[model samples]
Target: MHYNHYGREPVQLGVGLLNEPCASAAELGQRCAAAGLVLSRAPTTADLASVTEFLARWRAVVECVERTGRAALLNDLLAEYASAPRLTDHAGDGWHLHFRDPGVATDRQIAALVTVGTALHLTGLGMDRLGVCAADGCTRVYADTSRNGRQRFCSPACANRSAVRRHRAGRAAR
Candidate 1:
């Protein structure tokens, strides 16, 4: 039985979706394939637009977590994405669990994976592990899997930029 490493991969995929929304359904299929997920459907170009819009809503879940409301926001996302639990090992690997049913739509599948993965990550780590980038102009979402859990920026470059901006502001205040 392969234990799904459901924490980081889904979050990274979510980030990728947010960072570069698919311009066409084929692009969406390609992107998910690159992310190591096999799409059950061949999405049409219109589906790509829907996926982008759905991802925008998913980003809202990140945006709602402002040091507080983390639990509430995550709960909301989980509720939105997760379905009634069911047992499935139809691939004949081993008897494991599936939150949603098989043959679900592409967008729903992505959302379920992302929401459950995000919930698991935040709960397993800490409620404060997810947030927006601390960089001045970057609204990117960051899931802080750091040991210290004090991570703020989406990337080191953003962190450095934010630090420099803070230093400059301090100097100017003097």
Candidate 2:
């Protein structure tokens, strides 16, 4: 269940943003860098707005995965963002894939990356891999990369809280 950039980057960006919560253009640039994304230019206000849209679309993609009949909905969303793929060693890291043509708008670039990345993630991993946290009253998303493929909570703290709640509920019922 190793995650490529396609799977790993956006998921990390989503979770990292949810955890630390920042959106200024500088903040977005920093987040992308930390996620090992190679941005050709410094982020601008427009990029911030664009990535923000990516965040919203990403949330919907997560939700779509949980619905019974909406499984194919992600493909439609990805289709809207689709671009021709090109291989590049832009960062000199190694030859890798880019989903968009060179010199596209920053926002569209992010959309392409996220859409392609998520598609790869869902396909490379299992369709059941990404899911909502099982902890009661929590709605955070998680990419279930656990070896057993049984991940439920977004974090250990949530798992512990749910456990304590269940224990107390059982005692009350008893």
Candidate 3:
């Protein structure tokens, strides 16, 4: 479960922002908590903005993965945000490795976590596992963490919508 932090957290952050840019801090906090990341303080509005900016950078990385440039993109993010891996029991929840230093702002922490997580997810699951949704009128991005690695849309809802559209189009074509 701790190991999943390297992949799950970042993807959750990215997908949350992608789905709703105006999400409340409470919403994000809950999401993070569910990912096992307990916060020492409430996320500020600046933290929200930081997540917005991080999403832009993260989107670029997703685009890179699409273009088979993930390595270069990951390298850039690591250079920009990720620090040396260090272990700590900051929360006294037993020791865990942190990819960035302590006492950093929420946004920077998110950047570091996402970058390292993304690198691990891509390498472990295959580079093609992360991408934008295939459904029309949807710009959501996703990390393919499915056991079968066959995720195409951001959610089953989007996939069902696409399938219905395709079915309707086929009927109209005939």
Clashing pairs in 3: 6-117
| lDDT tens per residue, model 1, 18-49 | 86666677777777776666456777766676
Q: Largest lDDT belongs to which candidate?
A: 3
TM per prediction: 0.84, 0.86, 0.86
The 10-residue segment of model 3 with minimum total lDDT is 1-10
Residue 160 accuracy (lDDT) in model 2: 96
Over 4 Å off in model 1, which ranges?
1-5, 66-68, 92-94, 172-174
Q: lDDT per model, in order?
A: 0.75, 0.73, 0.78
Q: Candidate 1 vs candidate 3: which has greater lDDT?
A: 3
The list of candidate 2 runs beyond 4 A from truth reads 1-4, 18-20, 66-71
Q: Write the per-residue lDDT of candidate 3 for residues 84-162, one digit (tens) a residue.
A: 8888888766777888877877777777777888888888888888888999988888889899998989999999999
lDDT tens digits, residue span 20-70, model 2: 556598987888788876677878998887777677767776766564433
Error of 3 at 153 (Å): 0.4
